[model samples]
Target chain A: MWKRDEKKPVVGIFGFSGCAGDQLAILHMEDSTVDFFTSADIKFFHMAQSHQEVPEVDVAVIEGSINTERQLKELKEIREMAGVVVALGTCACYGGIQYLGDDEETFKERMKYVYGKSGETPEFLDLVGQPKPAQPISDFIDVDIMIPGCPVSEENFVPIYTKLISGLLPQKYPMPVCVECKYEGNDCFLLHGKFCLGPVTAAGCNATCPSLDISCVGCFGTYEGANYPSMIDKLKEIGLSEEDAIRKLKMFGGNKVEQALKGD
Target chain B: MKTYKMPKNVFPDFIELIKTKGKLFGPVKQKSKYSFEEIKNLQELDFDYQRTIMGVKKFLTPPKYKTLTFDKEGTKDIIDEPETNIVIGVHPCDIHAVKILDRLFLGNIKDPYYASKRENLIIIGHSCLPDDKCLCQSTGTDMVEDGFDLFLTELADNYLVWVGSDKGLSLTIAAGELLTEEISDEDIQEYVRWQQKRSSMFKTVMPSFKYMADIITLNYDSEAWEQFGEKCLSCGTCSLVCPTCNCFNVDDKILMNAEGGFRERMLDSCTLPYYSMVAGDHDFRPDRTTRLKLYYTHKLKEYIGRWGQPGCVGCGRCVTYCPVDINVITVSEALFGEVCETKEVCE
Candidate 1:
């Protein structure tokens, strides 16, 4: 009988500056937690445990965006060490909410609003560049896969992780959440004069908010063929202004919105 | 397909006939609103109700379900529950929603849980007399001609029943004793007139869906999103009440002391800040503006492009349920233009 390879595929979990909800969501997978750990060789995970070291790994699951100089440096090093990199959440995949301010002055103003005059002092690192606007991992590194949820859903994570471990790329869910929402049998909020984002946002969440008697806020990123202008009109008909509509789109899928604004 | 008419007096017998097979669910008054619930007596049925507070989607796809359960031994068990039941007096929008779901779960991969429930249950849809809040006609879903096993249309003093499938035919045959053989042409004409009148009652017609994708594409930075976000509480009410919002979160429920656990999938909303949080303390949609934008795009634009159908069916339940009353139609029209006056005819 042939002996099987004893070594397991090395895995690493990394985070950036955000609420850390995605990590908590992963930890919330109580049943799959042990299996997730046992399935791979977790070389580096800073949030779940205290011990941490940068080791070359087969796959690196990165969360958050390239916000600070330290984050950028760390991300570059992770890119060098890992063979494959997966942008694990909306923050890492689409720049999340931190990229709300597209203009430099607006971003600076928002920073001032939060930190005041004393906070304007920039933290400098000798080697790395200054902190620029927050951006998804794809802007800096080639992301092999992207799981785009505000906090990536466990429903998506399990299947995706399984595929990754087996050396297969998980298929992108081209369908929006409205497809699943219809399956769940909730009422459509739009007809009632309520605002909803089910049409343009990606569909992985299965329309949870609507089912619970709320409108979808589009935590998931935009689908491949999202149409923004029409949706804005729909919202406007329901009484929202054009400027407000675009701001909402920029909150999650800022990069895409920027591209769309540029008529790309 | 066969159509027949029964006297208004025969309605009681029809309820009794349905009761012979199993439980019958129909509209019932709960507090101030109408809802679909199990009826043991005919008196509990509300034949004249305008709409139900909740749609009949849950009977097919439940709020919380387990796709698969796994233990430490690596053994996995998928949960499947198939039950036989009947849903009476379903509205047109809800029936359309069910049909959309059928395309997703039954027509495609055949979700065992959804399939099992759908296969066993019988749907009896009702045509409504339009109310002020109803906009189904605007979205082209005011009347459903298919998807239900049997369709009911209320006439002057009776109901005109249309059998849609072999299952419906069998059920009609089983209830043959209660059904009347003779029906007048005037009753059929009156039913058609009522439907036409109902369609006309809807004051708003949703903009053509063909231009929806393009409209959303053009208004990516229209600046209207922030206005709504400023007022948004992020309470997640809009997503919860929407008929087609299907986002969910899965987690494991471990017993005390970490002895064992079962992975459970529960309803989750994108409106919540934690919904997009990642391991590295990063939140994808930290601001309310982006979250709100996501909800609108998914329903009006992204869904139609991907699934070949619009996500929203103009039910108006969200408007009714929202504390802030952020109307989707108004927002969409503001961003895209008036549905009636927009350029580029959808072919």
Candidate 2:
């Protein structure tokens, strides 16, 4: 914990290959932006400011997955400078949706299709070096804390930020989205024979989709002690085939769901 | 208890008089489902519904509510002035469930929050016919003699209102000309016939429900739990809808500026993950099977051992709402069936 005599903790916000939606989520905290700026010494945040320099910081809040060799090297440098590292958003924690396309052949083919005519490597690829399969930052560096969500919900982010600035470790929330869904008083989609992954998805979004009568897509990743086999069985009972159930479970569950499937 | 007969035509005037006592709330249809909502007048009330999504507990211990607010100056309890809320159309099983909650929250150790809410909130129970899902008959909560301020039993053309408390007497007195003390022989015969008819409508009954305490203990290691666990989602819908389930988790949330924060208590469930989790991430019931066992054994067996009554009121909320059909009836039947099949092996 920071002492009274100690200076305000300097914090750095960094992003890698995935969409910087997590940082945007933090920026979207209009009510807390002024307090956030005043509480911490934000030394390096390119999205919010310029003239960014690579400096040793108290905490590094990193978002997105390590998707390239160049980005991985930069991440190592950030790891060296920061005292504490926080993996923000689903991408930094579970590699996000890009984990589904993690195959070498699939990654290369998709890259070629998007940026190349047919066979030749794109100029950007040559400039940035060969792209790597999307993987969470924890695969490369130690992460002190992880805030997992597609866009790192404000309810989770704000409290974590306050704790980080106060030099306290953030608390973990292992509850599933169904907890919030029950609080919202929304009718259970599973009861209605609709496919909802809320039972296994990490909560913090306050059952946002389910409240609106939409099924949870597992964007927040698998919750702790999630019953994967049971969830799949339920999906199948709701008319989803075995193959489709596993595919849906892996949609945003990423490598974590894959690991559970292996254990099963 | 004082019994009064109110003719069908005079009920509207009595209801209008009762509305003046407090905020009138009753079961109202929301889409195909029913919920306890604020009723503007008699037209909004729908007593024909089987069950509301939530029960009287929603008024006592809400899903989420503030408990305390603290800042640099210290802390203050966040108890708002108790409002007199009169909830109508509660079923007898739900009334019994409230009585169970009262034993827990208002007995030797009182919960101030629940006590405050319970003191001000009035429960007006209404009669209900049994459906296929209802098991209140087996649980012996089909007809409640108490735990309600006023219980209105609907007859063919009139209502037999049983005043259970001074609050109920006050309502009757305020009703003045709308209520009559006259009791007819035909009214008694009609009430008896109505009770018989309602009793015959029960379709679901758990065999040896009272003996479940021993059965649950003997079959503690039965494979029935594993089968149910395999299908259980651990979504907590059972606890959420169960009127007798009253577990809660408290959290302190800091404001963005770090100047202040408030403590909040939200409804929690034993079946949900982390319900038995402590600091250092040590979870007592880490697997779904163990959690499922705790949920069933606690409600079905342990509650009986402690309070001489099962924690479940047999309201059939779980029977109606659980995505997978792993309710008290299925669980008790499965365990009982397992014991019967293995009688020779055990003996």
Candidate 3:
């Protein structure tokens, strides 16, 4: 229990090079917005407020992958200044969709495809210092905790926030989305010869898609110690070629999935 | 056991009489599958179903439920007294499954949650014709003598109702004029013929089911387990559909305000990840092969060792529900090499 006279822990919510969905998730906590604002000192959340600098904080919650040299330096600075560094979304934890192209040449080719061989885009790229390959924040700094999702789930976020504010270390289970799917009492899509990554995907979204009869695309990233060879074989049995199955597995799993597939 | 004969025409009125006892539930067809759903009238029930997607266990131990609610003051047990439930059209195998569950939950040390639901539930068994998926003949659960309040044997033109409990007798007394105590020779002959026909109609017989405990032990390290494990999706569908798979996991769900929370209990499966995980993330059964072995061993081998009967009632739910064909029939056949249908396992 915190005493009335105890100082509130300062928290900073920062975003880097991808969609700011994680910060939006925090803002979307409608019922608990007041409680969150009252409990902690949210010193620097640019999405919620402006005219704020990166101050020394008790906790630094980061979102998105590091795609630029400037973001890489700022990430290191935040790690040095904050007591606890949290990777708040799939991008910060696994490099997200932005890191799908792992090699420098592929990144350059994709950049050219999206922006064209035009002049203004090159100047913008020069300004950002040659546009490094998108990488997770943990590549440069030590991450104390990882809350992975395309947009972090509110059920996961709220409880982790509660524990962090209460000065307790939050714990997470490494179970697959199939666990939640079973509890939801949804029919298995795989049983009907449909492609679903639920057996290997992380559990957090509460099997949202499968509850509605849609197959899981595994946007939450792979669960720890996932049995990938069996998942790939199942996908193959469902009529997906081995290549397509591996591609779908790597779609959201990023470098971690790549390493796991390599190890297999 | 007191017996009565009711004409087919008066069965609807008997059902209506029992409706006043509690909310009536029976099997209803949903698209291609069947499930136990609440029904207000008699026409909604489809007695021709082979199996319901879920079983009678759903009413006893729900998929998820709030067990406790707490705040800064203290925690409160939110174990509300559930309403009375009358489940009709339950098959004999399901009745046997419930009896096994009773031995676990209502035995020596009773679970308050299960005890409450079990007390308020009324089981009305119904005779059914065996389909190819039915394997109850091998497990000796093809017919039930007890474990239900009332049991019905459908005849050509009449209904034979057997009262197995005082509640069933009370229901009979309440069902005045709809039933008659007179038992004619024709009615007896019809019931015997129906029983004989049903006993002969079971096509999927596991002749080696009784010897599975020994076979499983002998082939504990067989390569067939690895072959089945390779095909396993680890999706936990088998445990969810199995009437006897009653393991559960409990967790505390804190409110968004962080001021209060509730404790929740949800059904868990041994085949799923983290079912055997402990503190420091040390999982005793880390791979699918070991976990699948535990599931079958506990159901087929260990339960027999403890209760003198295997936990499986030959409901065939796992056979119908598992995405890949990894069920009792396949596992037992593979272990004993009785059938070579799954040739890879036999080899």
Candidate 4:
């Protein structure tokens, strides 16, 4: 994955089925965008650049989740060519919204709603193969770091990005979003009878949603050792069914919720 | 105290005069909530607004600010002290909140960043109409004896103003032609009547407010916290809006070159699970219930010990804003031995 250029780190930005929201987060870095682009040599970023060549880059910031066989193949190739892979958003980190599926059969059945006549198109199968249940980059490749957010906030991304470019191993804070929300002084959504996944969700976004009085949707993956069973009990106490709470927990990433569902 | 009377109609021109002095901020009605924002038009200032969505503590301590900046060049202080800014139409609870914040930020080491902003600040307090959500009256925060630059009490045709500081006197003198002689005895009586009326408007009270510190300490391992934690988003909303919760975190952001970046300040919350987490992920308050308990303990017990004042001024923002309705009053009552039947509010 080592590139010819020895001066600056060559970077490639990629996306898959999920909304390119995490990449869009890069654009929202208005204060640091110029410095970011100037510091890193962009090898391939189809979202921002016109001409693209997927040359071996030092690092790749991959957004979205792997859903199709073609995407899986592309992901493996990316892993082969990139030295360090950073999962750039909730989708790439937690399988995005596709994690809502409880099983493979249900995942395919839900795909029918998207593709329209899922079994009818031979052309689709020939090019992309069968759609798979969404999974994080860690499932397919050796991910070096994971930055989770719906559209990653600058405060979270900038520090991590700076660390990567500085050749330092990025440190991950396993705190929940409540850490940031408390700092910003946001009101608890659960108190207002709104279902917020903040208590169990990973911290980073500086509690963006709650600052503006919006409930956190757990766009960031679940916190480290997140107590999902307790969160489910919380949702139940707040008037949501256990199934509904589990479904909402699986809204972003299923790894933790799946474990909780299996009584982990 | 020097008193002046301004006709209700001349209030608009008087506001325009205040604008020339500095950036004027007042309560602006947004959909269902009111916020302290730049007052562009006189009509935007609500004379009888209920409460602002957030407390006035935010003005003293911003959400994000640069404390220091370091580079290969040199390290230097970069605290951006603001110019003279006026926050008009402040409610009594928030005025009391500012006072609590002042005791914290200005009490000990004297935070230079907070002092810089506080020095340039001017408060214009408004006597507002009370609603069911307001508990400031019952809590003795219905009126501020001091701390405001100018306090306005509206009468039928004019506003009864009390100049609390030299800054208030200057503002009052600036409105030379707009100002009249001392408020009439009838107007003073009207102000007194409004005070009584506001005092009678409180619908909710934390029965344990008087002995909150002792009550919270006595119930260190209360089961009610576990119940509230079961429904807690742990978003730290209570601490943020408490006005007295001034905890902060500082981080140094270095540029890739390791040459330069700013050391910035961010808000920190005790209610967060990570607030007590140590090295090697040794979380002291790993559970949500534990964290929530610590937050209440700080506000009610620890803070009261630190300063003579009780942390909560009964602004009731936490109750009004809690999405799931874990009221402080009800929770405190439960902590102090009252088995509450009502799950939502404590009356």
Candidate 5:
């Protein structure tokens, strides 16, 4: 539950190491950008036009996941200072694409690939431990609300933010994008022999890809009731193999698809 | 509303009558697929086709349109128009899509651009006679009861037109002498039978939209997502073909002189790594797996809960178009469970 104040709820938008598309999306809300700024008392939004001190917030919206040691500490501090913490995008809600290398060895290999042979690592104050696999904010801290989008859709973000400012908890959305795609009357991509991920992806985007003469690539992650095996089987029947199917499932979904396949 | 049964020869006469008012646009053959375009000849219309490659929304919110233009003097101009156009041969699913867009653009803030186009366009829908890939019946969107000026159901040799709105009634009157005032109960009943039979052709039926939400939430930590992500190429083909993916990127394209430029907005997908990039060079979704998961969860679970409807229409386009073959229904059923006792359609 959220409580509204006369001066507008204290809102903070923070980000970690991932792409800033989610924050950029906020900037892309050109029509409502001024309204959003005027309506909410933004305490911290690092990616936007300002970079002010982080203050106590009623609702702290965090983007990206905890991938580094510093991110872990900052997230903990954010949790301590905010009344409610919301995961703003797929990165925060489901670890985004950075968590692909879930295995410790693979993660280290990739890190080494990028960081080079640095025998001496830089030291910093408040450094805690070695970085673990990237995990959604919920895996580290309690997330009151999870806004899941590759970059959160203005359709979902605006209303949720307004409700939070007004002291009302935004209602959760449950349908998949396929439903909207059907309503749009576009031809089914599958029938035309095109692969799509709409059946399993969530629906805040209003099935944008299908409307544009393309198929959903499952950017928003899995819906609550995704039927993974059936989807895979259908893919195989239509000329894909089980191996290819698994690879596609884990592209954005990560270990979630692995567990579902094993009936875990 | 009056109904008339035009003879076979009167088909050309009806086309002539409608063409006299304005340009007639219907499903036209483009390579292998059907597209809605202006029709100058009756033979060009492909009424018996399966479905159009794209929805009728392009008429309202086109893929690329200028929202605002600015000059050196800080002068900004917004482009909007109120024009009259007629769209024909729209399938039931497309008509439903128009209604959804209406709810999105008009139901909420009343988007001036979309509203203007919506108000100016006249929609004529055709009842879908089930195809092998359609599952609209299960999704509750197979019929064209509303959101159209008129609806036509194709019979054996003639077409039964149901005038739904004042615009449709006006169109009917304009083509008056060609139409008949008498329509039989048998004709309507036969049309209904044809529709029901058409629905039976679909192979896949998803679970209730409510159940879909539960499946995604309960299995957040499921392994299926990771497996799918591994094989996913992250090419963004799925989102591009999705009918309801409305995410876009806005860029200010400056002219050579730098005095003025128009702000250009283009479609974007979360599946792309750069989709979430910020000014500080931080890329939020760095891998393909996370991008894939974001799309699935949003479509099946989150958006449905917000809008009170399933996001997918059971169109098999994603599965068909995906180069990597990441079928959404397969993943959804694998997480939730297959629709039991229902015969599999895709086999």
Candidate 6:
């Protein structure tokens, strides 16, 4: 470890297969972006900077989930090198929308549909090991922190970032988005006969979707210790099919939701 | 209370006068709905609006605000009071809501943040036609007695204005701009006639629980809550749209335990699932039915006990906005006629 750059902690940003939406959110933070940049010496960020050398970093903020062996190996290396590992989007922490094909067999079938026969790998595609269903980084390496969101909320991310830079541990979110929705004075979409996942899902985006008159698609994943079965039951009672309810629950949560259901 | 006669043609001049005093916020059309927005241009005012989606509570007790901004070594107060301003085209139902909020925020707690906005406010109420969804009359909030600075009733050729308080007299009308005559006896007659017309316009909700406080209190074990909870999304929209809902939650974020952090209070709704969740995850009201009952009890019974009036101002925003057709009127009707009976009758 290079102990010389003590003033600013060396940070790295990495992305795998999922959409780069969460990283864009970090870039979109106009007010706190400067503070974040000044506080952390970004050593590896292929999306934002030109530097290609994957130098060891003090803090590694990894976005997206691992669907292939190459990403899995890279994630293991990151966990070994970085002092702190933060799984920054829903994909990194859970298994985001990319985790739709829940079963390994289904995942392979879907992959086959996207990329023909497995024997021939395209020039653009690089696969080091056999592909599997999308999975959270924690499925392989130990994650120090998990800040989940389809695109992580700046309201939640900025404050937590401030603490992380100060060498302080940010508090884990145990509350649901319903709390923030109440504070926002937004009408309940579920009450409106729309399928809303706010009650069982996490908060911290200031209930942005509901505020704009749209139902939450569980972009933040289920809240810690949330009653997922009850939520699914309620969703069905309100007209959402069991299949649809489970789909909505797993949209941002992926394998994490399955793990939660199995009491993991 | 003084009275003034403003000709139909020069209403804009009076608007200009109010604008000069401070910021002018009035009813304006937003898409298919209506909203109370800042009137930068005089022509943006849409006095013909029935209701706004958000209540004026946004002015006095805003949803999100900062209480303190501090670094570890020091602290700074960030409760910036809004500028003095006039809220035009307020309905009597909404005015009563503002009164309830005053009682909630200013009476017992004396919230400095709320007081900062409440003190600088100038309310201008107007006559409105009740729609099918409006039930303000049923709740005794259809017409306010003394909250506004000015009250306007539109007539054929002129707008009959009632100067409610000394603040209303602050405006000086130009010689030719105003009628410059005593408000005629015809003015009073026409105003009273409109009051009678407005009183008769409302269609009374059936099975009306005149003593709502007692009805809700007695039905502690009512199954109506279960039925309602089945339809309840627990999104807390009812409380958020409610002019009388004054629940708030405060949280502190201290930076590294070094530099001072900040404290913030945000609008909270009782209907939300986690409203009563405590440390170690002991939820006071875990189910939607219990949460719904808590809201109804607070609005109909508890608030009445504390403030001598029912919390619900009968604005019908909940009814108009509810996706499952869960209006208070239908619920009250159901409670009295059928659902609120004991298990014997319910079974």
| Docking outcome class, model 5 | incorrect
lDDT, candidate 6, at B36 = 75
Among these predicted structures, which one has the highest TM-score? 2
Q: What is the C-alpha RMSD of each candidate to the true structure, in Å?
A: 10.6, 2.7, 3.3, 5.3, 12.7, 5.3
Model 5, residue B248: what's the lDDT?
63
In the range B10-73, model 3's lDDT, one tens digit per residue, is 8888888888899999998866568888987898998998998778999889888888888878
lDDT of 2 by residue, B173-222 (tens): 88887878897999999999988999889988765797888998987899
Q: Write the per-residue lDDT of candidate 6 for residues A1-264, one digit (tens) a residue.
A: 111124777788899878898888988887666656666777887878887555688788999989888888889998888898998988888778887646866666776777886834466565355676788888889888888887898778766766676676675535577667755555566655678888777777888987788888888986764557667777887898988888778778788678766777
Cα deviation at B300, candidate 5, in Å, is 2.1
Global local distance difference test of model 6:
0.75
Off by over 4 Å in 2: A1-7, A51-54, A115-120, A126-129, B342-347
C-alpha-based local distance difference test score of model 1: 0.72
lDDT of 4 at A65: 83
Error of 1 at B288 (Å): 28
The sequence of per-residue lDDT tens digits that candidate 5 reaches over residues A108-128 is 676577667652334542364
lDDT of 3 by residue, A48-85 (tens): 98767666998899999998888888899999999998
A137 Cα displacement, candidate 5 (Å): 38
What are the per-residue Cα lDDT tens digits for candidate 2 across A1-264? 113224688889999867899998888989888887877888889899986766698889999988778899999999999999999999999888888645778877877777765856666676776678889898899999889999988888887777777666666657788888877767778888889999889888999998887899999988875888888888999999999999988888888888888894
Ranking by TM-score: 2, 3, 4, 6, 1, 5
Model 4, span B134-166: residue lDDT tens: 766546677787889999887778887889899
Candidate 2 chain B has its poorest 10 consecutive residues by lDDT at: B338-347
Give me the candidate number with maximum lDDT: 2
Give the TM-score, chain B only, in order for the candidates: 0.88, 0.97, 0.96, 0.92, 0.87, 0.91
Model 6, runs deviating above 4 Å: A1-14, A28-31, A40-60, A69-85, A111-127, A138-146, A167-264, B80-82, B172-181, B204-207, B252-262, B339-347
What local lDDT score does residue A206 receive in model 5, on the 0 to 100 scale? 68
Residues A27-82, candidate 4, lDDT per residue (tens digit)?
76777667777778888888788989886988899998887788999999999998
Q: What are the per-model DockQ values? A: 0.03, 0.49, 0.43, 0.28, 0.03, 0.23
- Candidate 3 regions exceeding 4 Å error are A1-9, A51-54, A117-121, A126-130, A169-171, B338-347
